[model samples]
Each structure stands twice: as C-alpha cells, then as structure tokens.
Target: MKRIFEELAFVNVFAPQSVEKTTDKTTAFVDTSGAGEVAFLVSTAALGAGKKVTVTVMGSDQSTGASAKAIGDAVEFSDSVGTDPQTIVVSYQVDPANPRYIGLKFQHDGDAAVLCGVAVAGRSLYLPAANGWTVAK
Candidate 1:
C-alpha cells in the first residue's frame, strides 16, 4: 500500500545547493602589508556536469576607493580534475582592465557526481574582500 506522506517526504523541491560565504575577520581588509588570493569551495550538492557556477572576486580601488572585481565566465563542469575524487583547479585570469580581481572557473564535464570539496587560492595582485572570501598575504 502507498503511504499518504511518503511521496512528499521523498520529494526535494528546492533550489540547487550552494556554498555559504562567511565573513573573514582576520583578512577582511585589503592592504599592501597582507593582501593576496582567496579560496572558495563549492558544495557537492550543486556540482554537476553542464552546471553553471559563477565565482566573483570583490575588491576596492586604492585611488578611487570604489568597488571593483572580476566575474568568471560560464563553463562546463567535468571530472577531469580527479577520478574517484574529482576536482579541478582553474586559475582566475586577471588583466590590466580588470585589476585587483582574479576570476576562476572549473567545469565538470565528465562524470555526474556530487562535487563537495573545493580548494581555491589568491594571487599576489589579488585583493581581499570586505564581506566575502579572502586570503592572507
């Protein structure tokens, strides 16, 4: 016999899983003394083939003091990073036009698995985030 609430209980009608960004107290401000790259891990629940994930780096202009950064382009998610434990490391392309911002994109285009683990790093030119992810110089 079919249960009354069994169907509803198994149903997962929600948005795609995502990583939660917390405030970095130690390296929250961008300075010359200690300013570098930032790493972020995307949740496995939302990691899949053909899935689109955008990573944005936030920073401020020293001269103008205005907000600035770069955004990653959409790419296919693949398992080329690893086999059983697939993970790819894509560096953010920074240029003179987009100064102080390092944007990276990793796509899983091979196997369809939950990508839960992520390891990201910041470059020397990269700046720290005010209320987002950042790394120490």
Candidate 2:
C-alpha cells in the first residue's frame, strides 16, 4: 500500500491567545477535512510540574456551527519531568458518513502555562490503480 501524509496544523510555540476556551480551559482546533486516518502529535518544550495537556479529536457535519461532536476519547498528558520536552501522539480513523471535518482540540490545565508545539497530520493509503499509478503519486 502507498501512503500519503498531509499536515493539518502546526504550532512552533503555544500561546494563550491562539486557543479558545470551552468551559474553564483553552482549546485549539485543527481542521482535518476529508481525511481517512489522522494522527495528532503534541510536543512540549518546558512543561512545568502539575501541568496537564489533553488532545481530543472533534468532528462536525458542517464547516461552521454547533453540530460538532467528540470523535474519540481525549488523550491527556501530565508533566513528569519538569523543563523537559514531552511528546504525545494519538491516532484515529475517520467516519465517512458524519464528521465531514475533523477538529483537534487541545485542553490545558494547571497554573503554569504549557510551553509546547502541536502538529496534526493525516495519512491515507492507496493501492495501485488500473493504470499502475497510486493515488498519492
């Protein structure tokens, strides 16, 4: 099988203003429309002790509005080694019927802000077509 990769979103360094709050914390959304498989990757440069980060995959039927739903369980991480870079990765399969666009939601907790970078990527595999050409190439 041939594999194709696409970058959904990237953040060199996280900032407070780049996120939207849902209830008590902040969230960053990444659009992964028409993706068959997705991988959410998060990296922290200097996460302080007691700090926590959660990455959740969200989806919606329309491009905008309140029809969004959480696709899967949120993947969470806590600072184990202070001042050390932490990385988190989560993978999911997209449903074709619903959730036309996928959203990556980042949730932050604790007093100290998380100094981190986040990237979302999608992977698709295709077999060779009748003409001996793959979908990616």
Candidate 3:
C-alpha cells in the first residue's frame, strides 16, 4: 500500500519573519535531486499600502548556492499587494530539469512591515518521497 506521507516531503524554504522595506532576503539552496513535481508556498501576513513581495527562483548544482543561477522568471503571488489585506498562502509549481539544488531570493518593498514565509513540498520520481520514514506493512 502506498502511503501519503511516503509520497510527499516538505522543506522550509524560508521561515515566517518580518521583512524590512527594500531589503533583499535569500534562502539557502534546497536539494531537489529526486523530486519530480514541486510546489513552493509563499505565505504572507497583511501586506498593504503598495507593499510588495517579489520572489525569484534560483537553481544550483550544489546546496552551497555557489553555482546559483536564475532558473526562470520571478513569480509573485499577490504583489499588486495592497489588494490583499489578510494572511494569504500562495503556491507555485516547478519542474526542475538540470539543477539538483534550488533556492529562493526575494525582496519586500513597501511602507509597512509584513511577515512572510516560504516552503516547498515535493513528490519524488527517482527516489523515496520522504527523506526518512519507516513503516511496516
């Protein structure tokens, strides 16, 4: 029998925290070697008054991020930003082909301070979905 937990894995891309205006925040590269389809969740707390969160994806061959490079275009969940007034959870899907490691680089620009976080959940195609789990049948 296939278990749901056995087919999915989650990683903290960026923990929830208050981001300062015009400051660039970056996350360490995460290994996605065996993942097939991955979803990145960007959560925010009350982004208002033209406050914006811009996120860009970077791909690397190593987790150290020394070989990091832009994988694709930047994706913003709700950057029109004043449009949303409450905590929102936005998600994006990615299928990395060449790189084994991926990281996020984002910036928040606005007049108000906002709490934002990011995470990734992925399904593996070349290896076990979960990092480490023991289940008996």
TM-score of each: 0.32, 0.61, 0.71
**Candidate ordering by lDDT (highest first):** 3, 2, 1
The candidate maximizing TM-score is 3
User: Which tens-of-lDDT digit does each residue in 5-81 have in candidate 2?
Assistant: 23333432234233322223323444455456766666656556766777766777655524667777877778776
Distance from true position, residue 16, model 3, in Å?
A: 1.7
Residues 1-137, model 1: lDDT tens digits: 65544321111111233333221111121222222334443334433334443333444444232444435444434433242443334443334444442323233332343424444443345354775675657
Clashing pairs in 3: none
Q: Which one wins by TM-score: 1 or 2?
A: 2
**Model 1, residue 98: C-alpha shift (Å):** 1.1
- Which ranges of candidate 3 are over 4 A from the true structure? 1-6, 79-97, 126-137
Ranking by TM-score: 3, 2, 1
RMSD of each: 16.8, 6.0, 6.5
